[model samples]
Target: MSKFMVLVKQLYKQKVSAKSFILTTLLYLVVLAGIMYWSEIRDLIFSGDADTIAVVNETNFDVSEVLQNTDDYEYEYVTAGEVAEKLKDGDYYAAFTLTDADGKLAAKIESYDPLPLNDQQSFQGMLSQAGQIYAMSQLDLSPEQQQLLLSSEPIITLNSINEAAADGKSADEKMAGVWISYAIGIIIYIFVATYLSIITTDVASEKGSRALEMLLVSVKPEIHFRSKIVGVFLVALTQFIILFGGLLLLLRFSDGGNKWSIVTNLLDSMSIGYFLYVMGFLFLTIFMYLIIGALFGSLVSKVEEAGQVMMPAMMLTLVGFYVMLTGMGNPDTMLIKVFSYIPFTSGMVMPMRLGATDISAIEPIISFGLLLGTVLALYFLSLSFYKRSVLTYSSGGIIEKMKTVFKVTT
Candidate 1:
């Protein structure tokens, strides 16, 4: 046990050697900076409203009053002629033409570019409301009757059953669930990219430098291979924990505010107990994915071949990632449920379901245990294959050989 610990430490140090450590640290810093810069960049690019509109013959049926009533856009009344024509030339975004229809009104809006559907809907609705009010005032009904005809309930209203109700989770919190899914997808990519590359280069270097033959003289292949796997897994997990923990701390104190508190309450909607449970579940799944990825990584004979072998793992990760994102609102299909329990895809898929659904507390705990068991089993299974494959370099029959190792172990 002590020797294994020593081996693990040595492997961690070797994998995270000074040069590599500095490279990864720099990469992480760049990623964080890019994330921070994105929001600022969006604000800068989309800053303020350049929007201006022109209204013609607005007094008797003033378009400015109606448009301004909606608070949709800023408008200025303009007179018609060649001067008004040139004014409508290029400076204004849109022009509204209003005409009297006896006791009624008719109108049309023109814009250089096509107005967005949502903007069109809003502007048309405001015009409709104003027209309705004008027609109502012409009615012989009393003011009370006019109020009765015009008054209506808002489109949406919520009545809370619980005494404690929050404004609900912000867009950021709702998006955090999706973004967190994306983050797990990213974590899978990082692990697969970093350590698979490590294993490939390690294998290629070993074969190229004749290190395997020399190292085999003192240590068994299985011990060396398992030690490498253990070491690489530790390094990957450690880096992930640092990044995740740091992100949590950043978010906890973030003044940026919640992005989607409307969909659900950020704090009140989820029980603290389940949130922590799911987070723990997420960490375990990441560790499992790293281990399985490292196992497949050892079989590559050359550094270039590493990516080809990793395709299966990548597909598995992609399936989980997209399913979580696109299917968040969809009911659980058989495939999602199965993927949630399966080892390879569980890391990304199940946690997303947990976040979006109000599942029983026991389900996440049971799922965590199942994932933990699978990871432990996979470690031994992968180690057996690692033992057989790490020292052999022929290209054609690697998959067949892996099967043999599994067959023997089973």
Candidate 2:
């Protein structure tokens, strides 16, 4: 047991200290942080010099005053003559004219280049609101009438007969749930495939060389095998810790401007318990795949064959990923419910159901128990014939050699 611990520690340090490992971890951290704070980064890169929008108000009221300035456009009230001169000299991004046309308010925009779709949409929405506000002010209605007209809610109320559909999850919340499920499934699928490749290569390279045999003389092959798996798992965990740690620090320090807060609020809707359970399940799922990768590596006689043996694991995870997509459409399906208890497929499917559905509270626990049991079963099974897998060097396909190993061990 003490030797196992020592071996595990050595393996961890050796891999973690590798230049490639450190570079990869740092690169992942930088990329994730960049994605999370993309808006801020965009502002830093593109702000400080906003294009001026020369406003020509030929109407009685001020249109520019009613509209808010954005980082992309700064409003500058100018004369009709000044609008032409400023635009000619490239001092203005565009000219916005507000005038009375056909006895009603009208607006027009002229620019050197065609405006972007987003900018056009923004201008139209805000100008429409400004027109409404001006028209409202000109009316000789009572204060109560104005208040009634300004009420944000629809005049016709919508009440669902089904209470569960209206369980405080807004349309936005449900949308967020769908996207979150997608991210979870993709993360599991990609991470499992990526780290599985890493583990197989690590094992196959050593097993293909004389070093594995010398190491087996000091330690039992099974213990050595598990130590390597655990080590690789730790490497994966370290990368996640750095990535999530940076996220936590950002959440702690940054004000999370308007766009970022919307995303954070969507995440905040879930209970702490759900996050904890999903994280544990994700860890178990990855570790289980890593174990399988190690086994595949032990079976391969050549170091280069490590990547070739991942077809089975990839196909199984792909099936689970598809189930997750199906769950996003309808979580109450029998397909999702049944697969949630299946160890191989549950990693992605169960998380989708938990976040998207309000199923019986005990169901997740039961599913988790099944998954935990499967992981332990696989671990012990791997320990039994791992020595045979590493020692035998017969040349064949992964399954053929694996069958020979089990055949001899049994």
RMSD of each: 6.4, 4.7
TM-score of 1: 0.68
Model 2 over residues 3-116: C-alpha lDDT tens digits? 889988887898889898788878877877787677788899998878888888888875655776888778888888877777878999888898876546688998887889
Error of 2 at 223 (Å): 1.3
Score candidate 2 by lDDT: 0.80
Task: Enumerate clash totals for all models, in the order shown.
Answer: 15, 0
Model 2, residue 40: distance off in Å is: 4.6
TM-score of each: 0.68, 0.76
Task: Report the lDDT tens digits of candidate 1 across residue range 106-166.
Answer: 6678787788998788768877887776677667679798788878655654444654443
Q: How accurate locally is residue 316 in candidate 1, as Cα lDDT from 0 to 100?
A: 70
- Highest-TM-score candidate: 2
